[model samples]
Target chain A: MARVVVDVMPKPEILDPQGQAVAGALQRMGVAGVADVRQGKHFELEVDDALDDATLHRIAGELLANPVIEDWVVSRTP
Target chain B: MRIGVITFPGTLDDVDAARAVRYAGAESVALWHADRDLEGVDAVVVPGGFSYGDYLRAGAIASIAPIMTEVVAAAGRGMPVLGICNGFQILCEAGLLPGALVRNAGLHFVCRDQRLRVETSDTAWTGDIEAGSEILVPVKNAEGRYVADAATLAELEDTGRVVFRYVGGNPNGALADIAGISSADGRVVGLMPHPEHAVDTLTGPSVDGLALFTSVLRASATT
Candidate 1:
C-alpha cells in the first residue's frame, strides 16, 4: 500500500488565534512548559501511483482545503 | 455591467457566481486563471473553491496566475472586484486587501446557513443595503476563520471597512461573526459566505444574498 501524507499551515501573514488561545489555556492550566503553538492539519491517503501530480493537485484545491485560510502539502510513496 | 468570473482549475463556485451576476442584470463572462485579458468586463469576481488545490496555500498558487496579475492591475484602475471564500484568500495573496484568512478555532469543516450584518454597505457590490441590515447566506468551509492582527483589525473597525459581520448564533461557531469586508475605496469586496448560493429563492437559503448582487446593479446603473 502506498502512503500519502499531507501537511497544512496558515500563510505567513495570517494570524493564528487558535494556536495562541491554546497556549494561553496551557498557561492558565498551570503548565508553563509550552513555548508556542501554531495549529495546522495533516492527512494520509493510501493510494496507488496511478494518479499524476496534476490530478492530485486538483484534489487538493477542490475539497481538502478552503484555500482562503489554509494550505496543504501532499506526498506519495512508491 | 459585464462581470467576469475568474475560474481557476479547482474553482467550485464560478458558475454560481456567474449566475448571480446574470440574475443581477449583468453579463457574466468567463475568465481563466492563466489568461491575461479580462475581456473588457466592468467587474471581476474571484469565485470560491479550491484553486491550485489549496496546495502551497489557499489562493497562494492561483494568485500567481497570469490572469490574476491583470486582475490586480485592473483593480488598481478602479474595476470593482469581489471574492468569496477561496477568492477571499486569493485577494489577500495578491495583496489587494490587507490581512489574511486563517483556520477556524475548532479545526473542523463547517457548513450551514449563516447570518451576517451589513457593517459597511457603501461598497460597489453592497451599496444597496443599509449598514446594520442583517442577511443570511450559506457558509461551507474548513478554514473559514478570519484572522488579522490587533492593529489591522482596529484600523478596519475605525475606518468602517468591514462589509459584513457574522450574526453569532450560527450552528457552527465562527469568531467575531465576521462574514465579509471591502476595500479602502469600497470598490473591492470579499466575504466568507457563499452569497451565490442564496441568490435563488426556491433553492437558496435566503433572498438576502440577492441584494448583494442587485446592489452591484444599482451601482452600475447609477455610474
Candidate 2:
C-alpha cells in the first residue's frame, strides 16, 4: 500500500472570513500591527515511504490544493 | 431505502429534511444529536438548519455532536453525505470536507431562489447528472460564504471536485466567484444551496432540486 499524505488549504482568491473577523476584533481590542491573518488546516501523513516527493507533490497540488487560491507544504514523516 | 437524517439541538430543518427524504420514496431515520448509532441506513443527509443556533460559528458546535461519530464513520465507509447550508458548515467544521462557511460577505441575511451550475456529477451523490447542468435552488443564510486557504481551492477545481458553482450574476464572496466544493472522494459533497426546499415543484422555485436526491439514489445503485 502506498501511503501519501494530503494537506489542503483554501485558495488565495477565497476569503478567510473567520480569520478576517478575528483580526477586526483584535484591532478593535487595541491589538496593534496585525498585518494579516490567514487560517489553514494541517495534516500529518503516514505513507508507504516508497513514493518520492514529486509523486506526492502531484497529489497535493493536483487533487489536494486549489492552486488558484490555496497553497500547501508537504513533508515526509514515518 | 433507509436514509439517516440527523437532528441536533437547535436544528430547524431536520423534520422537513426527513419529510423530503420520505417523499422521495426512501425511509427517513431520525438520528439524535447525542446518539452515535446510525440505525442501519443506506445513506445519510446532514440536512440544513440553524444547528446550535449559529453560535460560535454555524455548524461549529454541531460538528462535534455525539451522533457525528457515526456520521463521520459512515461517510468514510462510502455512505453518501450531503450537507446543506448549515450542514455544509458542519462538514467544514468537522474537517470531513474543506473550507468554512462564514457570514455572507455583505453581512446580510441572504434569502433567494439562487441558480447553480453543477460542475461535476461524478460522486456518490451526483453520479446521475451531467456536468455543466444548471439547477435552481433556494438559499437562505446569514452566514453562508465559503472560505478556505488558497491551495485548497485549486485542488478542488483542478480535480473536478467543485461539484457546484453559483450562477454568474454574483462573484464568489464578492471577493471572487466560488460557491461550493467537495473532497477528493465524491462520496462527500458540500454546497451552500438548499436543495431540500426545491425538491417539490409546487413548493419551490423549481423541481430541479429533486434531481440531486434522485442522483444520489442512482449513485448508490451504481456503487
Candidate 3:
C-alpha cells in the first residue's frame, strides 16, 4: 500500500473567515509577529501501490477540493 | 404539469418543495438520488438540506448523484430547474450555475425571514412576478456566502442574470448582495432563500414565493 496526502487551501483571492478568526485569537493571546493565517483541509489516502500518480491527482482535484475557490497539492509518502 | 422534487440522503426540504408544487396546481413526483429516472416530469426542484451531511463541501457530494445526470441533461435541453439553499450549492458544484457559496463572513448559521428584491423576471421561475418586486422568504444556512471572480461577476451583472438581491441588509455577505441567479438561457435558477417554505400564508412570511412555482408551470406549458 501507498500513502498519498492532499492539502487543500482556499484560493488567496477568496475570503477565509475561519482563518481570520484564528489569527485574531492568536493576537489576543499575546502571540506577536503573526502576519496572517489561512485555513484549509488535509486528506491522507491509503491506496494500492500500483495506483498511479495521475489517478491520485484526479481524485484530489475532482473530489477532495473545489477548484472554484481552492487549490490543492498532492504528494506521496514513503 | 408534473414537477419532480429530488431527495438525497440528507435532504430536508423535499416534502416542502413537493407541497409547493402541489400548491401551484401541479403534480409532484418524488425522485431519489440513487435513481437515474426523472419519471417524465416537466421540471425539477433540488431543495435545501445538508445532503451527504454536506461532506467535502456543501452540495459537492450530492452534485454527482445519479439523478443529477438526468437533471443536467434535462436542464441542458432547457427544462426549468430550481435549486434552493443547499440545492443552490449543488447546482454550482455541478456546473449548472456560476460561482460558489462559501462559509458566511460572520461565521454563523443564519435563519430568518429575509426580504429580497426580484432583479429579473426573465427566468422561467420568476416570470410570474414583475421585475424589481420585493418578496419575503426564509433564508437559512451556514454556507450561503456567494463568491465569483471579477469577470464572472461582471458578466452575470451585464447579462442581467442576477435573479434575487437581498433587501434591507445582506444576510451572509454574499457578493453584491446576490441571493439568487439564473442561467444564461433563464431556465435554471439557484437561490439560497427557502421559497418552498414561503408558499403558504399561515406558515410563511408571505405568499410571494408561490409566484415562482406558478411562473414555472406557465413557462413549462408555453414551452
Higher-DockQ candidate of 1 and 2: 1
* Per-candidate interface DockQ score: 0.12, 0.06, 0.83
TM-score of candidate 1 on Cα atoms, chains taken together: 0.76
Please give, as one word, the docking class of candidate 1: incorrect
Tens digit of per-residue lDDT, candidate 2, span B27-79: 88898889879889888888888887876457867887888878888888888
Q: Tens-digit lDDT track for model 3 on B1-223?
A: 9999999999999999999999999999999999999999999999999999999999999999999999999999999999999999999999999999999999999999999999999999999989998999999999999999999999999999999999999999999999999999999999999999999988998888899999998899889
Q: Give lDDT: candidate 3, residue A11.
A: 99
In terms of DockQ, the best-performing candidate is 3
**Better candidate number, 2 or 3, judged by DockQ:** 3
- For residues B85-151, write the lDDT of model 1, one tens digit per residue: 9998889778888766656656667888888889877898888888888888998887667666667
lDDT, candidate 1, equals 0.81
Show the colliding residue pairs in model 3.
none
lDDT of 3: 0.96
Q: What value does DockQ give for candidate 3? A: 0.83
- Runs with alpha carbons beyond 4 Å of true place in candidate 3: none
State how far residue A1 of model 3 sits from its true place (Å). 1.8
The numbered model that scores best in lDDT is: 3
